[model samples]
Structures are given as C-alpha cells and as structure tokens.
Target chain A: MRVSLRQAFAYKLDFIFTLILGLLVSLVMIFVWYAVYANSGVSSIGGLSLNAMYVYFFMVNALSFITYNAAVAQTMQEDVQTGAVSTAMARPIGYNTNLFLNSLSVAIVGGLTVTLPMLLIAIVLSHTAVSPAALGLLLIEVLLSFAITTCIGYVIGTLSIYFVNIWGIINLTGFVYYFLGGSLAPLSLFPKWLANILMLLPSQLMMYTPAATLLGIIPMDEIIREIAVGAVWLAALVLFTLLWLRRISRRVVAVGG
Target chain B: MGLKREIKFFITCQRYNWLSFLAYRMQAFVWLSLNALFILYGILTVTIIYGVSSGISGWSYYQMLFLIGTTGITVNAVWYLCNPNGLVRQLRSGKLDSTFLRPYSRLNIMLSASGNVDNSTTAISSLIMMAYAASKIGVDAAGMLLYAALMAAGISAFVLFVMALSVLAYLLIRGANFVNGVLNFMSSSSKYPLSIFGFAGQLIFTLLLPIGIASYYPAEFVLGRLSLSSAALVFVLALLVGAASYVLFHKFMKGYVGGGG
Candidate 1:
C-alpha cells in the first residue's frame, strides 16, 4: 500500500492535469446553474433554495473528485484482456488483494488531488457557509460514498471478464448516474415518481447523499439512514464481486496470451 | 462506373453492420430505447423550464426541442459514422499506412471507414420533431434549408477540429480518449440555447469549441434572430475552420510515428 501510494504520487503530472480538468468542468457547470438560478430569481425549486441548490452542486463537484474508480476498473480490464492477469495471479499475493490495495492508493491520491484544489477555490469563490459540524458530517458521508463507489468499480472490473466491451457499459452507466443521481440537477426537478425510483438505485448514494448532507438539506437522522443504506449497498456489492470473480474465473478459457 | 463502385462498397459495409446488429437485435433495440429516453429527458427538462418562463431566449418550447433534437442528430451522426473509423486508433495500429498506399484519396477512405446505419434512428426522430416544431413556428422551406446547411457545416467543422486535436494528442499521449470524453461533455451542453449562458460562456462555445454554430446559430437563423448576412458569415467561418483543421491534420500526419511494432 505504501509503495503504491508513493507510485501514485510519482505520477504527479497525470494527477495535476486531471485535477485541472475536473476544476474547469466543475466551475463551468456552476456558472451554468448560476445562470439558471439568476433567471429564476428564487431560492426554491420544489422547495430547495438558491443557496441549497448551490451547496448541492458544490458538494456534487467536490465528491466527484473522490468517487471515480473507473480508472482502476479499466486497468484491471486491460490486464485481464491482455493476459497480464495471469502474471499477477502467479505473484505471492492474491490478485484481488493486489488490485484493492492499488485502487485504494490511487483513490487516495485522486481524492486529495481533487479535494485540496477544490477546497481552495471553494473558499475563494463560493459564498455558502459550512459549519464545523456540517463539515465533519460531510467528510464522513464523502468517505462512505467513496468506499461505495470503489466497490462499484470492482464489480464493474470483475464483470469486464465476461463482457469484453466494458467501455460502452461504463459510459452508459456513468451518464445515467450523472443525470439520475441528481448530480446535474436536483432530484426535485425530476418527476416525483422517477426521482423516487432513482433514489433506490446505488447512484444516489454516490452524489445525491453527499451533496444533500453537505447542503444541510438532509437531517442528521436522515444522514444516518443514508449512511446505513450506503453501507448495506457496499456489503452487497462486495459479495457480488466475490461471486462474480469466482464464476468468471472458473469459466475463463484462455484465448490468446 | 465510379459511382457504381462507391455504391457497391457502401452497400457492402451497410450489409455487414446490418447482419452484426441483427444478431443482437434486442441489444440494439434496448440501446435505441435508451437514446430515446435521454432525448425525452431533455425535452422534459425544457418543458419544466418553459412552464415557469414563457420561453428561453425568446424561443418557444417546441422550437427549443427542435434545436436540441437537431443537435443530437448531428452529433450522433458524426460519432457513429466518422469517429469510430477516423480516430487515432487506425493511425496507431498502422492501418492508415495501407490507406496511404491506396490509389483512392485519403479523405475518401477516412470518411468511408465507418458506416453508422444505427444513427439513422436519431436522424429520423430529429427530422420528425424538427418538422413539427418548424410548422408550429411558421418556418418556411428556405429557412429550413439554411438551417440544414448550417448544421451540416457545423458538424463537418466539429469533426475536423476534433480530428486535429486528436493528432495533437499523438505528440503528447498515445490515446486521445480523455480528449474525446471532454468533447462529448462539452457537446452535450449544445442541446440548450447558447444565449442562455453568459457572454463569456457564449464566446467559449463560439470561438473556442465551435459548438455554437452546431445548434445555436442555426436555430437562431431559423428563429430570425440572426440576419441572412450573419448566417452566411457563420457558414463561411465553418468552412474555413473545417478546411484549416483538415490541412493541419495532413501536416501532423507527416510526422506521426506509428505506435507499437
């Protein structure tokens, strides 16, 4: 883990460029939503205030920095497809353990890369207040969300063994999560039934819960409920990953080395 | 004879894709349904906004839908037909070397590299919505024709610009997947009217990204916001941008070192 962390920091240029790209996109989206709020001139959309909306979007952008695990999934998929998985399988450590440690290291680096710069920018440009209590809660929510998202990445990577073309699936899932998870717009903006249905999906745990917590839109009790829900989902996802890996490994017929 | 040969080649490519898609017809149907669902989401968002405000930037709900539908169609058309074949992969894999050796023009080979019969669904749906919106907005045939031409030019310019950017990526990174993702996100914003954004945002889309011409300017022309002269100027600008990018790409190709052995 320490070695991998050091390696992740060694790739500083990729991290910096990716951080800059994330910041630029987040700023652009904020400005877009700001325009909408300015035009509407109201604090509430289906009962969300302007400040609430801004806070929600800010948290969305911030959490987006830490929650990406697609890189790990893609790396694992490449290894599996190119027969590098067998090389790792021959190593002393289990392949899954190695991947988890590597993913954790990279995720830590990515989280800091995004969160640190965003913290500076948010302090300078944003007007919303974050109380110490709220900040602490926000941090907890973000960590849980990060864990859940990483588990999702593992499941996705494992499934890539069966479906060689994971690119389209990743993209499609990402799009659905972005929209239906209420990252782009508030859940209240969606139809009530559709919003309820989306809340049942794991995607809402990624962006919506964190954003809601940060914005103080969710009550403390509700935050506890969401965290519980996220933990349950994570547990299920891990189980699913184990089962999938076992099934696929048994069915795996080596094609070309 | 040349036309016949081209037609035969196109038909052969079409048949190949058709057979492959037919093998997984359910998957294709599901994918098409998802695409439609996304469009419906866009329309629904616009409807909700219009419910509060009479229109966005003086355009009605149906007109906004038309703008979005057309933009979706144009973008998917490029991605489906041109991008899969024209991107850095062929160059990296040395497949482009064979094209260079061929008697046919490089441009022709590149353009025809991928066929997107599936994307016709988007185009067909867009046309239906566009027709409905145009009739409601009292758009004449000439206006529609001008809009169509602008859309074509915009799509061409965008594809060329992106291809040029991909070549630039060769000097830096082997794969331009990140660039492609960024472009896809930026283009997604084109579904809305550009005027909704601030002046700086508008300028970024117009000059930096060129997405304004893709949907906004043409929609503006249809709505009579842009004068004929302005539309003509935009058309000319699109051609210039496209030609310049094509030239840049050819120059870049001269120096491209093929990836891998």
Candidate 2:
C-alpha cells in the first residue's frame, strides 16, 4: 500500500492527468446520455430518468474502470515474465496476500482521487439522496466486486504464465465489462434475452447491479440477493485462486529445481 | 522528384510491413479478432440505442451501421498506421531512431514503413459490413462515390490528427498511456450522429479533432442530413489540420533524446 501510494504520488503530473481524464470521460458520458434523452423524446428509457441515467453512467465509469484495478493482471503478467514471481513468492507475507493487497491499494488510491469526486458529482447531478445504510451496502458491494475482479485479474495473470501472452484475453475481458457490464449502456436498455443472460452471469456485478441497487433501479430484496451472490463469487474465486496458485507454484518450483 | 521518390519508397517498405504480418500468422489472428470485436461492438451499441429509441436524429439503424462500418475502416486504419500503442513503444524504446537511419524521408518512414498490417483484415471485413449496411439503405452509386471521396478525405485528415496527438502524448508521459484510450473513445463516438453533440460540440470535433470528417460527415451527407456550412468548414479545417500535423509531428520528433532503450 505504501509503495503503491508513493509511486502514484511520485508521478504527480500523471496522477493529476489521470484524475482530469477520468472526470472528463464521466462528463462526456453525462453529455452523451443527456443528448440521448433529449433526442429520443422520452422522459425515461429503461425506466431511468435523465438524472438517474446520468448517475448510472457516472457510477458505472467510476466503478468499472477507475476503482477496478486492471493493473493487477498487468503486474502479475510482469512478475511472471520477469521471473519476479520467484522472489515475490519467497516473501513471508505470501504472494496471493500481496497481490490482493496491492490490487486494493491501487483501487483505494484511485477511489480517493477519482471515484469520490465522481460519486459526489453524480449525487449532485442526480439529486438522489444517499442514505447511510445504502452507503454501507454500496461499500460492501464495492469491496466484494474488487475481490472478484482482482481474482479474475489474477486468473488472467496466471493464465498469462501458461499462454505466454494473453493481451487478447485481457482485452476480451474488458470488452465483456464494457458491453455486458453496462459501461456503454445500462443492461436494462439491452434486449430482454441479452440482459437476462447477463444477469445470470457475473457481468451485472461488474457495474449494473451495484450502481442500480444504490440508485434504486433494483428493488431492496434484489439488492440483498445480489450482495449474497457477490459474496459467493468472492469465496469461489478465492478458493480457485488458492488451488490454482498452489498447482502453478509447485510446477514452477519443479521447473526451477 | 524527391517527393515522388519518398512516396515510392514508402509503398515499398509498406509491402514489408504486410509480409511481416504473413510471417507471424498467429499474431495476425489476435489483432484480427480484436479489431473484428471492436467493429462489432460499435455496431452492437447502435443496435442497442435504436432498440431503446429511434436513436440519433435523422439517422436510421442501417445508416448508423454504415457510418460505424466506415469508421472500422478509417479509425482502424489510422490505428494500423500510427497505432498509438506501437508509437508509444517506438518512442519509449528509442526505436524511432531506426526510422532515421532509413533512406526514405522521415515522414514516409513514420507513416507507412512503421505501421502494422493487421488492420487490413479489418478493412476487408468492414468493407463487407459496409456493403451490407448500404444494401439495407439502398445508397445510390452517386452517394457511394461521394461517400468514398469523403472517406478518403477523412482518412487523410484523421491520420495526421492521430500522429500529432501521439507526439503530444509522448510529451505528456503520464497522460501518454491514454492516447489510444482517447482515440478509442473518438472511434466509438464517431458511430453516432455528430449533430447530437450540438453546434459547439460539432465545432470541437470537426476543427480541433476532425473526427467528424472521418465517418460522420460522409454518413450524414449520404443520408442528406449534412449541414453544408459545417461540412464545408470541416473540409477546410481538415486540410489545415493535416498540414499542421505534418509540421507538428516533425517538430515534436526533436523531443526524442534517445535513451528510452
């Protein structure tokens, strides 16, 4: 955490540019959706008012791109490529623990600079009152989403060690999030068959369900159900990562020995 | 005579670029899949938008697909040529100096000699897609001819536009990584009507970015919704942007004091 924060702050200009760009992209989405509303001549499409749509896009960008630690996969790929995984695994703190923490650290730092401001702007623009209880639930979901995504990242990263290259896979995952995850448009607006399949998958957890839950697009009962499902995903992913890591590390050791 | 030689040299080296793709057929598949997905993703976004509503003003679903298919050709070609990602790697590794050592003029080397041919697959696929969209709309021969002309014009302008931005990105190292991210956004946004952005937004995209010329203006003109005033202005601005980017790209080359290797 300390190292990541230090590295981020060391590139002060890069850090600032990233914040500005994040805000700019979110602002552009706001403009684009507002145009959709005006030109479509609909007060609401997908049952989201213009303001609610604004909040949705804003929250989706914040959660899916910024708060999401994509670099975990990149860093893991690097560690494997550079043979740093050997050194990383030797640490007493352990590799999986270290990877998970670094992922959270990157997210927390980004959440501080980009997500917080975008959340405030969305709240102000949408005028949706944020109750403390809802805020707490949102926090839990965000943490859970981070874990599942980080596991997904590690899985891809681990796969990189196997495939020797997975830029295509990484980008394919990003595309899934961009489309099925609701970064481009709300899953609600998608064709019923598509949206239903997406809901059955974990893609909705990527952006739609959490943001929709807080914004009241999903009902209270559904929100609770989504949270429970998210927890299951995290547990399953964690177990998979552990078993996968143990298997890979043994092979790595065998190869080296 | 000198310019003719450089052009000839560029086309020759460009053959080598394509040969290199054939050399590594697997890498080509990766890029082919990525670009194909990219084009389809743009088409899907339009479908989703229209599914929800009539979609962007004065543009039907097929018409939007036509614009998007054109962008698959234009934007992906720009990426193929001065790919923001490859440019970053070239600049970072100081491999740009390799271009300097070559016989051809620096401009030709930078634009033609350096690009990957992976997007050629995209060009072929997008042409088929564009034809499908055109058949849906019954775009006439004249409209197709004019659209081709507009695409040629837009491609030239956007090529320079991206080359200039890539240099600017190198100047801003922290922000440099996102040159392509911004380019991707520009690519994706071009699929919809530019008029949706309003007059001011239209001006920004046309004069400053020139992406409107890329796919939007051609699509709009064929659909008979293009504003002559804006379109005329954009054509003029695109020429100026193309000229300025030529100078700026060369100017910014001085910033490379190699050791990024």
Q: Which residue runs does candidate 1 get wrong by more than 4 Å?
A: A1-21, A43-55, A71-76, A150-163, A239-249, B1-41, B44-57, B81-86, B89-95, B109-142, B172-178, B257-261
Write down the DockQ of candidate 1.
0.20
lDDT: worst 10-residue window of model 1 chain A: A10-19
**What is the iRMSD in Å for candidate 1?**
4.1
Docking class of 2: acceptable
What digit string (tens of lDDT, one per residue) describes model 2 on residues B205-238? 7777678877778778777776657666656766
TM-score of chain A of each: 0.83, 0.90
- TM-score per candidate, in order? 0.81, 0.89
Best by lDDT: 2
Worst 10 residues of 2 chain A by lDDT: A248-257
lDDT of each: 0.68, 0.74
Task: At residue B11, give the lDDT of candidate 1.
Answer: 64
